[model samples]
Target: MVWRPTLPTKDNNVRLEVRKTYKLYIGGAFPRSESGRSYVVNDAKGKFLANASQASRKDARDAVVAARKAFGGWSGKTAYNRGQVLYRIAEVMEGRHEQFTLEVAASEGLSASKARAVVDASIDRWVWYAGWADKLAQVVGSSNPVAGPYFDFSLPEATGVVAVLAPQDSSLLGLTSVIAPAIVSGNTVVAVSSYERPLPAVTLGEMMATSDLPGGVVNLLTGSASEIGPWLASHLDVNAIDLCGISDAEEARELEALAAENLKRVRRPAAEDWSESPGMSRLTQYLELKTVWHPIGV
Candidate 1:
């Protein structure tokens, strides 16, 4: 009798895990790179992870357009309303705590406990910024005492569109620190996540998509920051840029030069401790101070 190989039984079959497809979060939607490109991401031990989209110049331009389009509505919302929306995002993020913890651990090469702590801090940071959304005007704006018989007041208004290069080292915490402050003041953002550790940022984007935050208010792109940074800096419509993630001095200067074409409010990169108290500087950086003088007897 001829020996025949038996088909594997159902009980002996190995189950395959369902992997996630990481894509760009733009205009409140996930899209594959228009360039049809992706790059491999590996773990700290050089283990195979997942592939992330490689954003192109076109993608950067599209993100700016989305941010510009959303700016009016987001900036028009009452401060109280923006606060509520930001708080809602924190709420949504809390539900995905486990996922964030895992991603943070994998992306940053931290132990589970440490990753949990980082995730916790990231969530709290978001809430902290949310609390300041409505109160910024009182702290930053002022009632001027003028010699003339007129009521003089100063108010903080949102800058149209901001481009952010999220910190490459402190993925989640640093990413949160830069993003929350910008959006809390009604400035829409086009942020580039860290090149090597972008998983946590992508997870954050997923949470934002399901939250009360308006689409385009915070668009996240994952790819080569060096490739996309120049396009964003030079874009005529971008109002401001945070260079906190650019590590090279020469490259930062080059980007700054490009940004000067539009006089974009440039936030030069500085060494930051993400765990430390984040002052009001970032919140006020992208705001425009508008003063109004009302005649005493009009």
Candidate 2:
């Protein structure tokens, strides 16, 4: 039998590199696709990066189950506790900054400098959203002035499970932008990562597990949006859908229709600079406002 020689580097020494396989982040564990299917992931230069799980309808269903089971505990936590947990995510992300920069560079075709900028912004975004958790209600809710002798007030509540389609173009930043807002308000998320660039998202999921985020607080799926988008939109248990990553009008239209079946709160995709200040718009969208009145005669 003929033996094969090891590949040599420029220095003439044999070299081997171990590549990482990307997988679905559900219930705080990385699992292969339930269908046992995977798709090749290529970098900006069209080089093979890794194999990403091709999540199936059953995977989406499982994610919904995880998110629903997590919602009660997550939303029940004190706002201050939630804020601390969100901040821990930022801390973990900070420790993994180099990994994110490299992945963003390969995925987006950005130079090292530009990729670093995006990574920095993404981390800062978590901090921004983390602060909002404890303060959003105070900023958005208000006491109403009524004509009668009654005290009227309005307050916000966390919507149930939210399904997120993360932005496809700006992988890291857009992913962080959409996710932080939804979960900051105490809504658990089942997010679909950037279809074209899912490495950073998978790594972020790993970070989430170690950062004090409970299992199922945030579940991530990587695969064809077209396949999972409709399933998520139509899932009866999902209370909302953020269509931020769906670029095609027809696709968004179809998903919107599916979401309408349950009157789900939908955030339709639109052109915008994700790096800009996100403001409170995203936070408000996932929130449910309840107004109440009490007789003042007592």
User: What TM-score does each of the candidates earn?
Assistant: 0.95, 0.93
lDDT by residue (tens digit), candidate 2, 3-28 = 97766878877665777788899988
Candidates' C-alpha lDDT? 0.93, 0.93
CA shift at 267, candidate 2, in angstroms?
1.0
lDDT by residue (tens digit), candidate 1, 1-298: 9997665678766556789889999999999999999999887777878999989999999999999999999999999999999889889888999999988888889999999999889889989999998999999999999999899999999988999999999989999999999999999999999999989889998989999999999999999889999999999999999999999999999999999998999999999999998998899999999999999975
lDDT, model 1, position 252? 98
| Candidate 2 whole-model C-alpha lDDT, 0 to 1 | 0.93
Question: Candidate 1 has which clashing residue pairs, if any?
Answer: none
TM-score for candidate 2: 0.93
Error of 2 at 83 (Å): 1.2
